[model samples]
Target: MASPWRPIRVWSPLLGLGFVVALIAFALQLSSRRHLAQRLWTFEELALYNGTDERLPILLGILGSVFDVTKGKTHYGPGGGYHHFAGRDASRAFVSGNFTGDGLTDSLNGLSTMEVKSVVDWRKFYMERYIFTGHLVGRYYDSQGKPTKYLKGVESKAKRGAQLLEKQKIEEDKIPSCNSKWSQQEGGKVWCDSGYPRLVKRPGDIALTGKISQRCACFKEEELGRPGLEVYKNCDYLSQSCSV
Candidate 1:
């Protein structure tokens, strides 16, 4: 006669393999659910998660992107100082420093280079500190939820501005230092300074000589002697030419 435990021992290896396969399938299901939960949210759906109803997470939008700010409820909740920004694409507000609804649009038209920089900084702040949820459908996106021409234009403008700023920094660094002769009689006088000539141009070919003359006049006093004359002495020539 054979022992009854012989059959159990023979099937144990097959059972163990089945268990391993089940565990792998379970893990894949969980991954799929997590990915689905993080799908893109429309503006209307985002409004429901503003932390006001106490049933959903706190969410905010900036630069056509949505973020899960639930972890920062103290600052993003209903009574929080930034609660007004919840559920809206407030990129313009971030740059303009206006927390009101009027500033809560994604439109960056007519904003200055400095303002665009502020928006970019704010976007970076959100990206670093919060969970990225999805993209907001707004001026940056079309009705079909694709990136719009306006969005491309904004990106190009920002790129150009960055390039211009870099160029300005390089030019500023190239400015020659001035040699100064100090005497009780002359007080302080800048000599042996090489001037850098920058051409000024505007639309319609208007002559700007009068404006240039006015700016040059302001540099005259600094040419003589002032307490903060060191900076002017070193970059006076560059200053007169460039807008720096």
Candidate 2:
């Protein structure tokens, strides 16, 4: 990566004049469109489609944060003059507009940054939700194997805080085991991660089934796609599955 300013000194005065002209034009355009009401579609239009009065507020709240606004209406930025309509925001700080190809919309999001498939980085998608929001993209599952429809990853809002997954970096460690007859009879068993027992990704020695732990905490009903700790069924499902 390199700056393109290597030969810009000769054009410095010209560039300065152009910049001034551009800034003034931008300012005037903004001032004129600040209060123009437009027909921007809210998140409700995207989410419920028809069913309203339920999650409409929540969805709109997110939409307003991701778009732009001028005066008091949704401003979709310059190209289209402005957005369709104002979305929603607590302090009216953000508004929904439009995005074509990439990047975030406004700026309100909460997702554990991770690579989803063999390709595609989820960082931009994660940011786009909270900043410049859009329709639900990801799906979160509880350890019980249930879909968390209300959210994809998790939001920082206190009421929705439980769904949030803490990004715990795993460290290697040896696990202890029991040598009981039943253990031996059942082909024995291996304890899961000795250090990160609650965050099991695969079948292992120890299964922390029904075990209450800070590390294994999942606020969302589902655990996204992390295997072993599904929330459905009775206790010890994980433990039994990992029986050695």
TM-score of predicted structure 2: 0.20
Each model's TM-score? 0.57, 0.20
Q: Write the per-residue lDDT of candidate 2 for residues 177-206, one digit (tens) a residue.
A: 222233445653333332212333422111
Cα lDDT tens digits, model 1, 1-244, are 8776744435588899999999987887566336425456677877777778654567888767788887888888978888878877877887677777677777887786656756766778999998887777767765566778877776766666666656644654444333445667756554333443222222111121112211112224334453333243345444533222
What would you estimate as the lDDT of candidate 2? 0.31
Best by lDDT: 1
Off by over 4 Å in 2: 1-24, 32-149, 152-172, 175-201, 204-244
